[model samples]
Target: MTKIKIKESKASTSIPTANPENLKKQHRKKKRKILWKNKVKHVGKKKEDTKAMRVLPPKAPQEFSSNWKTLQELLKQKATSFDKSLPVTQTYSKNHTSKKENVKGIPAISGGGKMGKFKSVNKMDCDPAQTSVPLATLKSERTATDKNSTEGKGNSKEHKKRKNSDIEKEQADIKHKRRKSEEHMEQHLEADIWFDDVDPDDIEAAIGPEAAKVARRKMGIEDKPQLSVEQVLVKEKAFAGLTKAVAMDCEMVGVGPQGEDSILARVSIVNQFGKCIYDKHVKPTEKVTDYRTAVSGIRPKDLKKGEEFKSVQKEVADILKGRILVGHAVHNDLKILFLDHPKKKIRDTQRYKPFRKEVKSGRPSLKLLCEKLLNVKVQTSEHCSIQDAQAAMRLYTLVKKQWEANINAKSKRKCVA
Candidate 1:
């Protein structure tokens, strides 16, 4: 094969330049962008600094002008502070006017005849000794005058109306920005106190007699004729009607290997009239694992001196037999005693429908029941069996009619079935 020689095509080696008009246009566009950015930044800065440019109300120049000599003397007294504390005066008209009003006797090098501007002061015209009032005294007087003016303004109903109207306008504006629910809540935020004219009977009707008593106590109001604590706790004589109804409470100590099992430690029975019928500490058959002294209020000494469990059980059974048994969680009490009672005759405050409803929970404690229904506090620190029994009996008495009627209605229905 023969090698063939070929000539190369000729082309320009120089780089191509852009159109001059296009370059000019690009340059103009670049310049405009920079100028626009600069303009935007300047506008934003001015908006932020608007507070600095705010105009204040013009002050009377006569106050400072008349007391120029006294003011000069005052300035001289604190020359160091006056020189050091001299603020950088703004070029704004408001700032100039304020400065002129403060030191009115000073001559202005420029802008003397303009509106809100002060003329030159001649120091020679006024005698320094004419008004001998000290600057300190004048300042105090000015403060007193200002206070008096504010008080006088506050006393005026028209001023009050204007202030209230202004407040209402602001509130209306805010309400427009908020939701209807928020406005409703804002209306409720305002609270009024009228303790002086509050009748405790009215309060009792509204809240409860117990809460009313508390309110009355706080207000230093005289209490109504009520039973004393001793009287409430121990009645002089038991009511004959309460013999059939009795409330019993048991205090138990922990037993078994883990101390979870409960055994009867003490027993208390109270009649419907808040009178204790029977109270005794019972010695447990099993060895006590936990005394539960914090809650049960039973000590080792009490248990040592307690009666036999069998004897106490028999006594309790005899008292509770064929009677309306009132207790908080009476099932637990009966279980601990190893005895059974008729369910129809049992009035357990814990299981009561009305009580559970008020408590807003299925299991209501003895303390809670007493507080809610009887408006009495019991078992505050240590469990008092007698107090609890009394509380439970009182609770039963509160709804005795409704409770008995319901029981009768249930029995009748059962008989029909």
Candidate 2:
């Protein structure tokens, strides 16, 4: 009626088990008087309570295999990407890891239903004759060995002993910190390549006249499709209100050799809501500077004599009459138009993120800002005025969304309190 944990070790070669037949015999012997009074047949019905597993000889040998078709398909399609950038870690010194060095022993069993005789299962033997060993046993053995050795040595090197003790203490501390840190760092693993080619320009062709009003720049460029005013209006309305601002960027050639460079190329802009806008490029009076040319992708030959700047500036003012002026570092844009616009209406994101002095990642380049904030990568290989302008607008709207949300939250809080 009681469980007996009879252990088998060097003293015995075999162990006893409570098999179904043995158990049945024991039950019949124990309640002989009750069984004799009420005799039953073992013929028809099965007992719901007796759901014991059938005893049989060990299983026969077998082989296992898996399909290799999936592996072959994966090997054929080797791909590459550079999209694994992530937030930088705080510090290298904070990183740590640790593992268990010891396990406690299992209590000894003496005819009770308790486990005993733990064995080391740490790759002790892969053979079929292997037995499960409790980790506690190995830890105790290791501890005893160290204690006995230390007892035998009367005068071990003091310095070496002290060094070992210090190292062990340090390891324990590291283990504690590592355990704490691991919980917060459960994240997706990733990798990337580090390469920096400032600008790899092959051609120096001056940028052609601002995209022809009729000739769609979208047709020629694959990455940057020119958006019509109608398309822009639709997109802007879909995201925010119809009262939107436009940021037009025009890059002109620089004329200078030794002194400060002269404006050889001009980027013009017009911003307005529900109105046609004009953006134009002007031919510089002198040579385009090396740096300016590299950035704007405008060559000495692209700025041709087609329309006068005086005529273009008038259209710029007319288009930008109703809409707000938006730009990144807009002083240059306003100066190029030759009409120092009012400071009140212009919104410069350069005054904020991705360009602010505090944000190290924010670059003066529009493409980088667009990529970092909007998750949309603009032209990086070549400079496209239309693409840059659109990117600025997209970036502005993204920033405004956050700004508006914050403003509305504060307004509500003020009203409630």
lDDT of 1 at 198: 74
Residue range 279-309, candidate 2, lDDT tens digits: 4566554545563555677654566742566
Query: Model 1, stretches more than 4 Å misplaced?
Result: 1-206, 209-236, 240-242
TM-score of each: 0.48, 0.36
User: How much is the lDDT of residue 182 in candidate 2?
Assistant: 61
Candidate 1 backbone clash number: 0
Best by TM-score: 1
- What is the number of backbone collisions in each predicted candidate, taken in the order shown? 0, 9
The TM-score of predicted model 2 comes to 0.36
The sequence of per-residue lDDT tens digits that candidate 1 reaches over residues 1-417 is: 999997654433232234577678878999999999999999999988996665343255544454455545543433333444565553244345644454343323233322333444433333332323345655775676579788888789788899999999999988787877765654443222235567877787556665566667667887777765446545575573348888898999999987899998999998878787789998878888899999999989999999998899899899888888998888989998899999878888888898888889899888777666655667789888888887787778777899899989998999999
Model 1: lDDT equals 0.73
- When summed lDDT is taken over every stretch of 10 residues in candidate 2, the lowest stretch is 75-84
> Each candidate's lDDT (Cα)?
0.73, 0.50
